[model samples]
Target chain A: MTGQDFPEPGPFATLSGAEVDLGRLRLRLVAEAERESLLDVVYRTVDAPVGRLLLAATRRGLVRVAYEVEGHDTVLATLAERISPRILKAGGRLDTVAGQLDDYFSRARSGFEVDLDLRLASRFRLTVLEHLREIPYGSTASYAAVAALAGSPRAVRAVGTACATNPLPIVVPCHRVVRSDGGIGRYVGGDDAKRALLRLEGAI
Target chain B: MGREPFEVVVERYGPMVLRVCWAVVGPTLAEDAWSETFLAALRAYPQLAPDSNVEAWLVTIARNKAIDQLRAQSRRPAPTERLPESIRWEEPDAGLDLWDALRRLPRKQRETVAYHYLAGLPYPEVARLLGGNPASARRAGADGIASLRNMLAPSAREKGPR
Candidate 1:
């Protein structure tokens, strides 16, 4: 049966008994939110794509994409304490990147085309992601092709590692980079998730 | 606000964040969003206004975080054009089974439902939260519900929602 309901919100007490379930669900969400803050108390937010991300910048360029929800100072403290002690917030470094991202989810864009501040990633990985960003929408490549493009023709496995470690995926389009012969290939987000993404994009 | 036991906050609001996240970004992204939401809350707990509605405030943060996740995921190359597969949408269920179903919806549609149903926010509020107009919020809500009904309904021979 359809899950549609009458115009008004359903009468929970009058409907099937799911109050306890609903209550439990609410409790869980609150718990998770609390736990998240605790973790950020230590680690500094990085552009490395941790939890949720908010991309922002000064007119100079994209600044940073915060993984944790605390203020910039809280994030900065963690960054200074852990990860790398050296951190700077360059302006406008991520504006184009953020705008492209906003356009993409609005369904106004099919793919990303922008210059990413991949300094967060290593040189080799940055090169690999650079090639990934060029992958046409709805198409895919192989580990070998990526390796070759990154100037490591024989490092297909290394290419796979790069893809696996990519701090940026969709921006780099690693999903579009697949097995040498066929098949979707391994993804950190899981095969079903990878396949689901492909299906959503009509790539599969 | 007095520092309520962290356990009390968790027991009361954990799943709300989870559902809102799952509704907005789907299962794949919800897990991290869920973790991140609490992490943010914990750090901000000391700063929360004493008079603030903790639920709404937390939901707002969670909503913002979820939106950010959706946006970030878009930049990462995925095989699909649709950010979230429609197959992920499902009615909220007991044991939080509804999360998997809600995950099937597109980020926009799923978000409409989450803000409206789970967070209990009005269309206008949902609009503000989503960076859209009230009309858009209404339309997105309607479209999401319609999609959910269709998705949850049985095969052609089965009975439909009354």
Candidate 2:
């Protein structure tokens, strides 16, 4: 019997399941974990004009944003593999970035004002992202122009690679880097999305 | 690469840990024990062996944290006997109240039951934690479980026919 005494020395006191508010208990655990710096990564997803965007951050700041096309689950698994496996889906560190993105998509904000963690980018790509951010809102820059601004005038192909592989996407303004002939370049968020972002900025 | 995210670990075992903690320390301090247990687990998760039995490991940590909480509690103003029986942690039960009956067991018997039955520690291991021998630990566990069944099970049998 489920509640019968353990003739073989089993425990009977836990016959009933505990009455626990798991959601509330998890909130408390997360709060304490965050306080102790045990929460290595906190991520959240936000609905943006491009699609549902997955946002991940460390205590360092905003790190990676993945498009709906990129597969959000894949992004999180890679984040867990590359970064600490201590990742959790919490929104405490991501609220500011999500709000900034909302403003950017609405054309109310011209620039992002959140700290960024660019650890996912290599040295040359870091240079490329730095130049991409200076491309300004409501404007477009040729990949060649971006390469030159990054102090690698002959590295136009590399600039395109950097833009395609940019981890921060919209926050880093990689969408503004277009083909020199004004053909919308290949984009991580796809051609239609790049065009939409340019249109949102009044650049098209 | 096979290491699970700490978030999964928490989700998989958080409830069970809370139950054991509630059993050991009661409702008032169970959350604190749970918080300490998981936070400690998080701090040391990276070094935890991938092939380890995470449930047993967590229970071991929970035992230590629960003991620490009890030790700290012992220094505080002792709670007098909970008379009038008005404050029931598990409420609305027409049958036997497990928390009420559990509170009547000796401290050693209570711990023996939790470690042996709930945490899945073997009797020898439970005895080691209790600073007693295996036979004594086994007896305490038997006593605790028997007391619970005697108190709670008859109600279940009688209610079944009605």
Candidate 3:
């Protein structure tokens, strides 16, 4: 700011001129927080065909994976309210998941092995999701079929709601659910993204 | 009412708190003070008034942590008698070499100057930490700066080349 104006003369500005390595400090902060168990959530974004995917995790495991259209800031705010507010962008915390996602998008991987925290979804929806993943890679299961497998044979609409609100999208394989009428149906990440994922998996 | 993600608070005020901690406690302990300050702040962040002065709150935490660190260091046996020439870093090229000059003042003077000048806190808040009226906090800061100038200014011409 002083550079934009004439440089002001004083001991004040020059007094605190020590070079602090913020990058180093941030890394150290992450390590210390982990050691103390003070870190509630760590998040980072990965570039993908789906645009930047905001990946959030707690110490337990991967929590939320959001598309750009979902509003990363808004998603983080919800996490702050529902979980703890002590979230930080630790560049390394999500490295494994990010790499796994890169593999998923590039088709080098067919399934996710990383741990997941699905506490955000309700119980029945969660049941629908568990059955959704068993559909296998590069395959489709009708929403009604998923609901039947989830023990709610008549709750096809509930199955659709579960897929629509799946918190951990590609990792949990909710994109594999389709309409029994031989249509693509809707997706949490929009049908276009769903099509891209389906096409990537060679399912379409 | 909503709260910002804690990362935003750290980015906004972390460096400033570190600088103030450096002035109050010296470089060796500043990072630890900063770490403790932010961790503590994060713990209590949700309860903080949304309109509160976040910087001032952080500086207050830093001050308390700095004092704790200083007390901890004082309890250790003095190392000076063991090593007459203690290892030191390279000195600044000009002025009073601010790091050393600030430490030479009394604690109240040093902290008053640091909070007001380095952290840009109002005199009332500095007084809150130092336990005096705003006028007294202002005087202490002025006296500290004047003392530093007296020690540093005359030496600039004479000591610059040397």
Taking chain B only, the TM-score of every model is: 0.70, 0.75, 0.83
Q: Tell me the tens digit of each residue's lDDT in model 3 across A75-156.
A: 9988887887789988566899999889888889998888888889979988887787799899999988898899989999
Question: Under CAPRI classification, how is model 1 graded?
Answer: incorrect
RMSD of each: 21.0, 5.4, 5.0
- Fnat of candidate 3 is 0.30
Docking class of 3: acceptable
Tens digit of per-residue lDDT, candidate 1, span A137-186: 77778888888778899988878887776645556677788897797898
Ranking according to DockQ, highest score first = 2, 3, 1
Best by TM-score: 3
- Which should have the higher lDDT, number 1 or number 3? 3
- Give the TM-score of each candidate: 0.39, 0.79, 0.84
Top DockQ hit: 2
Name the better of 1 and 2 by lDDT. Answer: 2
Stretches of candidate 1 exceeding 4 Å from the true structure = A1-204, B1-3, B75-106, B156-162
- Interface RMSD of each candidate, angstroms, one decimal: 12.2, 5.4, 5.7
lDDT of 3 by residue, B1-162 (tens): 567788888888887887777778775677777888887887788788778888888888889899998898799863331100111223443323565566678889989878887787778888998898988987898888776675567566466542
The candidate, 1 or 2, that scores higher on DockQ is 2
